[model samples]
Target: MISRPYDEIKLLIENYLKKEFSTKSDLIWSKPPSVELGDISFPLFNIAKELKIKPEELSEKIIAEISFPDIVEKVNLQGGFLNLTFNRSIFVTQVLQTILEQTKYGQNSSLSSERIIVEHTSSNPTGPLHIGNFRGSVLGDVLGRLFSFLGAAVNVRYYVNDLGRQIAPLVIGYFLLKEAKYKIEEKGDLWLGKVYASMYTFLEIQQLKQKLSMLGWKIKDSSVSLYRLDDTDLKTVPEFLNSLPKENEEKDNTHKWFMKLTRIQSSLIERIPEVYEKLNKLTSSKIENLESTTNQYVKNYQEGKDKLIVEKFREVTKIALDGHVETLNLFAIFHDDFDWESDVAWSGEVQTMLAELEDKKYLRHDEKARLLKNDIIAEELGYKTKYSISYEIPDTIIINSEGITLYPCRDIVYHLHKLEKFNASQCYNVIAKMQQLPQLSVRLALYGLNRTDTADRIHHFDYEYVSLIGRKMAGREFDYVTPDELFVLAQEEIKTIIEERNYSEEEQQNIANKIAASSIKYHILKMDPQKSVAFDVKKAVDPNENSGSFLQYSYARALSILSRSSKHDINVQKILESTEKENLIIEKQAEWELVKLMEELPSILIKAAKSLRPDSVANFSYSLASSFHKFYDACPVLKAETPELIKSRVRIVFSISKCLESLFEVMGIEALEKM
Candidate 1:
């Protein structure tokens, strides 16, 4: 509601500057440090500097030149700043009435006709989603909600990476351990995750052996069978390995040896020795042949030459995706599209993209593979190269020696398909920070192909990793907690909270599930996208903390208050109209502060939407909740001094509740009516 008046003030300033001084400058507005100072402040330093005048003089001159509108109660010059105070009673009435009149108060039509596609949570189907992956899902889902709230034609997509190298080892492990049985009821992705971990560990051991062979050191069969060697003997092996070095220095023998040792240590800590034993019992193939077989399967699947192998691979992927869907549904996430990498590969889009790049002279042959010419792309895009001390650009390989297209190549095709098929004007890929380079390469490639418009519209909504508060996670070692596990932990905490309630078992379960989902989602979304999150279950589920539960509790408390006031038979519209006439004033500081905070919602939403920062909204919600709590404590609504005062306070409470519910909806959180 205040956003409209704020924008009008900015426009008025801009027009006055252009006409009076024949100069243009950005009119930045900020809030006063305290309510007594003013409602908004504009610094005159920049304009004064440009016009070669004193800031105090310029401020006075501008205030004298511009006419004060009805909303502007007073304009005063304090030091070098111009401060404007609004008519408090009029401002409060306008803000409250706007909230009651418009259901979509904060929504703007700036991007009403624009089409947007947000691709997120494109994790490989080899395992269940860990808490780290959940960050991207929540971020993407919230972005989609925000865009939709702002009237954009939004489509959410999940890009399934079923055709990647990560899935090859998973497929091989499944084939080897198909008959293995466990008593626990495991989800398909969880089962595949165990197999992946085992296969990866076995491959690591084999690679270590191969490295030792290249160093002319042979381990006896008896030595290989042992789980651990004596510490003294193990320490001696590192010194011996360091004594040898290759002439070219390309292969650091000592470093490789230490890395291999580290892997073995990690495997032990992750209990991979037991997994390896199970894998050994299931497979009779020599370690040396594993890679070749995995490669053969990948090749045949890509070429569609072996129907049985391809079908089996698809079957496993289907099961994994089914699990993915169930997990996503727990958070109330539903995608409009689920795109597959194999579909892009088989649809000739990858081939067509390659052909176009070749025709544009952006492709070059390098080491028997087609590579994107980085120098040519850099020159064509007019990008000045700045050499970073720790960074270097490597050529993007479109196709490898084995005639299989790499992930980035497929991704470029996928992005192009998204723009054309959805008629999208903007697209956001909510991937991890690790993929920043690849995303940049794709954007550069698109620019080289004369698709600068598309390149400009593409966004990499990158975020850092999420870890446990006191624990580290290794995805390849299967040493991380899955989202399902986090959910269970959250539910346990919530169950303890509601154990003494009078609800049925079914109702308790439903409440616990909602609270659990909100707990995780709110904590992740509360952090800036660039910052790594150390997730703590206890902190997130606390009802009194700055969390989703607190927001929900505030909303529920507001509802309870409203229910108790049924005897008054309050009419919100009638109260809003009579607010000024009855002089039902905001006498308390807490009351005025709450009203002002509520007035900032529309502006906050605009900023959050423009900056693509959901953290801003999360933070704003916390502030509003805090201010409302303060008002509730200081001012009585039902037992106020006058009926008009009670009506005024009730209106404020109602607005706060509505605002919070709207925010919770956009953040993908459930606003519970009861905790």
Candidate 2:
């Protein structure tokens, strides 16, 4: 029921096709690079097929014949496309009227009421979050907001891997080494790396090796052998596409062992960037580093910095191969290390299922199984190479239980449990872009609804790493400042900036918040989920075209225009039809171009929500802000004295303010109360 300029434009286009060419399909509306290029573009790509004429001729003819309203400034043809520029005064007047009056200007039901749950952070409870693990937290949280704004009932939850081997070692690490504190050493980037690395020595490796030998994987064989997966046609696939093991060992492949590897990798890759940022505080190197400032703590036991410990830890990992048991923190270590009589294991009651092709039989063997997937099953279902994921049946693993031979239950349980716990509509898990195809196939093969409580649903949100340049910024390793630390630096910078500018405290805070929030959100949201980002605080905080301040100022300028006007009361539907410089502030294409931008709020909100990309909203707001600024410089509203013209411009400014306010909040940004 809501009206939009795009909606109005769509109607006009449909009518044009029907009346001019007797055609049926709607010409999709397109946006050219600049506002001057066009408000809406129609490529004759589709229409050319229906009409015998070439696209260029059709575009020129359409441009000449189209009957546009007075508010529409002019129609032009370029690059075989029809471009439009709207009259500024009318555009501004209509925009102010529509946004101010609409009950929901920028909302969409694109997702309707889909139940979605987004799980993020899921960081351990033991230590402070530190900057490394913050992206998943921010990305997931922002996606939840985007979904809600798009008309979804979204639930955001944090998963704690509390019941794991990773927890136990940390607890034991604390007990084994008391007054265990880490100090930032030198002006180097990764201050905590050496100390955290040294703590791996305390684990039991001898027992782990024996256990891995029981798991039927010899260290040497695991290190060297490769598992090759084939296509559905049994065509051999290339073997050059997998990560090599860190060493030759059965334990390296175990899920538990992988967890430790991942944890270390994540910390180094994810958290190090933020962690390394503390170095900037001593940018001049005149001040002492973190380590020199604090006394080295005494330990309960003398832990040697030696290589034997690393080897033994690797040996134990090879044996247990279960991060759940071997790499556990204190609680997980205690529970998993116990004899059967000592403790009960924790497993959720959710039942698991695997799809069985009814018509085909799976041939079972000693180490794997194979079966055929009927291509017919996906014929009408729209599952194919373009939009489909398929899995090749593997050679079955065989195991004997009580003299009865069957598939390996150990392998089955391992994959089943992990697949069943996928916490989103899409069983969302973070996979590096490098593993996209393989991981997606795994999801397709193990599809099922993961039931949650009445109010629970799964949501997936992704973000790029805050990077220094092109490389992904890992926690302290990336050497990017944490938001908390950034705040302090910002404070000092603000003091200097304010003193230089002769600005007030409020001005400093506003500028700081504008820049900081821009840096934080853009750094986290701008990249594709699968791609890792490198961070550069200086680039992120830059206030030129890309920075958040530009948008803030744009919104403030619109407000300033609105505040200065006395004639606020006016009807939105009143269309102005004038073309003078005095009236150009309202009549020029720039004015209505901004108005049309205001009209897109709900749709953009909905789109960004569905994409789970808060950056889309951030990006859109910036464009809207940019358009308004262009309007202000080219057209002077205060210069308009006619009662009708002044009233129209006032309403336009009011509408722009309302739209900006709603969007800024969604982007986790603030519209500057004053410029």
Candidate 3:
């Protein structure tokens, strides 16, 4: 909502400063911390650097000659920072008028109703949705909700890698059951999940047993269910070691154990497909009405080059599968024996993919460090300043033209083909870190894409690794904190503690869902993006203070207060209060600091969306909530007798609630009604 007015002021200030300094320099303007200080703060560093004069001296000269619009009340320089103060009466009136007048207060038209495809939570449809995958799901959903609230034309999608080999073992496991043919009852993702965890221990023993058997060694079959080797087995050890066949002093060892482990691993792997197939059947298909023709792997180029690559990729994939491992990495095993050159679809695409990579300059000529022709995609078309370099590195798996097996490049090629076909505004399949990004002194040097001065279109939409709750929970342990589960837990906890809050089933369910979701999202994203987190449960669910629940409580309470207030037209800026509230902002700084936070909403959103980190929104919500609570505590509203003061109080409530609503909604926290 403040974007249009804010933009106009920014331009005026920059132009004024440019002329005043008689030197064109990048001007920096920021939101002031306190509304009393003004709606905007302009740092004096750039001007100070140019003028060679102290900021205060520079400010007097600039303010005297600047000739700002009437809304600009005063400008001052303190601590080498030039601060601009706006007319409080005008500020409060206009902002309040906008908030009251609009049906959706604090809403902005910045999104321009663009068709945004928000893809998140593309976790393999293998098992019950785990907490680790919940980060992407919730973040993506919240972002979609925020975009919808902002008036963007949005479609939310959950990509399914239904075809990948991750499903194969599950598929295999399901068939192992005698009832599998008739019922297809137990899902493989569920069945193999436990099996997969146990496989490591299972394989460790089996692999060693096979190595002992290879030495023309006979084992006492009665002593053990499998091979039971003794000291005589040591006699069969290779001649170099036979003289001194020593056992490792270590209790558990990593040696000839792998041969037997490989045998068990292979046996279990043969059962994966049956297991995977059942899990796939369990999910209710939202894909039914999907009119998407893009489900099949597609590539451009009626050019014969692609088909050739596809075939070779399949050839290598065959070799990978035949190693008794069945599937290597991603491809599922073929149930029936097939030639390496099979032309069936979904059968050999990756090997064919690799066959082409052998032709590319970067793929074939690399050293032992695994050469990749990576594309580091920014969200938009423009290149970021080098320091902002990030990664969503995609690996490609390509098959060679000769049909020779090359193991390393498959991850890279698969990534490339998928990314190219999808063509998100800025989806880069960065082959590796070394080959991507702009070095220096090059602004518009990126390949093909435009590099204009404004924010690049695609770069703003590049994929970022979603922040997770507590090291982004993975494995089976993450089940405890999923938003889905936490949502219910928090609801029960909230219901018991805040008995005054009442709502119907639908309403309570919605609130509970929001509380649970917000807690998970905020807790996970609270840490800096670059840092790893091992989230503490006590910290996340804390209800007393500074926790997400505390913020939600404050928000719900503010809503409750206003919901009960009279619905008369109250003037927001009728009076400048004296006493505790008056000196609070100017003297105490904290109050003033809180007031300035109001102006930061738009910028915070812009920056957060631009950075592809929703944590920015989460952090702002907590801070805004804290500020509202402070203001609420210091000022008495319903008890005040003066009509004007009462009106002012009512107006403050309106603004605070509006801010709270907007912040919470953006983070996908359903703004609560009563608490």
Candidate 4:
């Protein structure tokens, strides 16, 4: 375990207060405004009041009476405040020695007894994951990593939404377009995405044409009675057409929408002409039954009434999901389990829950769907006031008239499944902000069903969208960059940088791949989860500053220094052992600043875990790297004037490398020995 110097130092002061004043102090600690003032400070106003001594006088008494530990160099009394400066030599030795002694230096048992389930990136298996989906994936994976680092038993799962409206188009397209001759140059998910997008666009175009035709007929009908006239009306067709309603807003709007659909259709056709042509034929033949077919496929699959349809649904979904898994594996992001929505739907758990809720009078039926009585539950539990909720929460649809289960209900059942499967104490669903209502409704449904304990433990780990500049993504239209495309874009940017380095083509490509992955992951993880990210690939991969590549570059630089040093120059054991007899001085200000920044890693990890924000850790790693760069620029490790200084600086570099490696593991970034 790494020693927490700040915490230990604070405890030492508390003991001093107890010994001198015979009183316990709830001490508040903060850094001095300037480094020259001291390392840590606390006020004497409250303690002086308790001891019946003026604060100014008390400060002097404490300085005279206090027994400073080896960790504290001295204490300064400034009016009512006491400032303690650390013995830099001892402080530096402790931080480095403790970090070297531990396997995972900053890990703690803070969540040792906790059993947690984190479900993220459960995008419907309709298409490949876009940049938006990648954000949640990285966030969730990093979260699981952080919790595990905190000694929690964490299970990271991906909820496969195998059965939903989103997947219906893909299923229909699989059979209808299987024999169609479209190019298969892209990955499975990308190709399937085009199929899905083409299906929707084609259907929309068909519907728009029919609508325009009907509106035109209505205009002609309004101008003349077709049943009353024959040859005269026909010969005067131009006159009657002129009499048609000229300022119809609905017709104008319909034309506008038709134009828009045509654009989307054109783009889809351009990408996959065979798919568009086949869809056109299918629609022209019997498009009226497309809806019924889609609904029937969903119903049959859900009820397990048709084995062939169910197999096809699973097959298509698996292909898309496999593509997703492959793309995420590039960045080292993975899930411990893939929990299927259909599996939970078919397990009889949803039905059993519905039966139980019905028995308990929590379930009710409306004209449109079966709803859970959320209002009654909220009133009974006083959730409005208890949880400080301001808005009204309406009843949530558990099952629609088509006999298909909705998301919230299936989600509730899945939560129970996860909880029981792992016997987890809490379940976290990492979904987008758009699903807040549904997420809350899941909790309300659980509460209404007399499982308030389980309801309270369910967490909606929500986040905002991630958009690429100048890129508009419509999932149904398939007009977005997949993770594969994003990675390619990143690799292209990196190629320009590493091409001039002393590496072969293969090595350069490998380095580009690693840097690209780190750039994307760090960019997403460095932002506040509640804030949307407008990701810039160039900024993400910038090696100059404040990026993952910069951090990696810093680590590689440290490794380079260590590689060039002799065994005697890099011996940390002798220095640490000698610290007991005498101080190991850190002479340079840059060195001292760097050591102080490294000391905060443990506290930073704890704060991030407790606050559910990985950005804190991301930002801290950047600061640490930036500080190391400054130290390296200011001090020469290999060319030091004395062998002792060289040995000390080498140890600093080694400790920093270890610190960075641990953080890389937590952030899912690759630590490159060479870049």
Better of 1 and 4 by TM-score: 1
- Ordering by TM-score: 1, 4, 3, 2
Note the residue pairs that clash in candidate 1: none
For model 1, the superposed segments whose C-alpha errors exceed 4 Å read 1-3, 180-184, 217-276, 285-288, 383-393, 500-502, 541-546, 567-584
Instruction: Report the error of model 3 at residue 384, Å.
Output: 14
lDDT of 2: 0.46
lDDT of 3: 0.46
Name the Cα RMSD for model 1: 3.7
Q: Which of candidates 1 and 3 is the stronger one according to TM-score?
A: 1
| lDDT digits (tens) for residues 246-309 of candidate 1 | 4636247546655655665556446755555666555444333566667887877776668898
**Which portions of model 4 show Cα errors greater than 4 Å?**
14-26, 43-65, 77-81, 181-183, 206-260, 270-274, 282-288, 382-386, 401-403, 541-546, 567-580
TM-score per model over all chains: 0.90, 0.60, 0.64, 0.89
> Of the candidates numbered 2 and 3, which has the greater TM-score value?
3
lDDT of 2 by residue, 32-78 (tens): 78876877777777787778778888877776777777766777778
Global fold similarity of model 2 (TM-score): 0.60
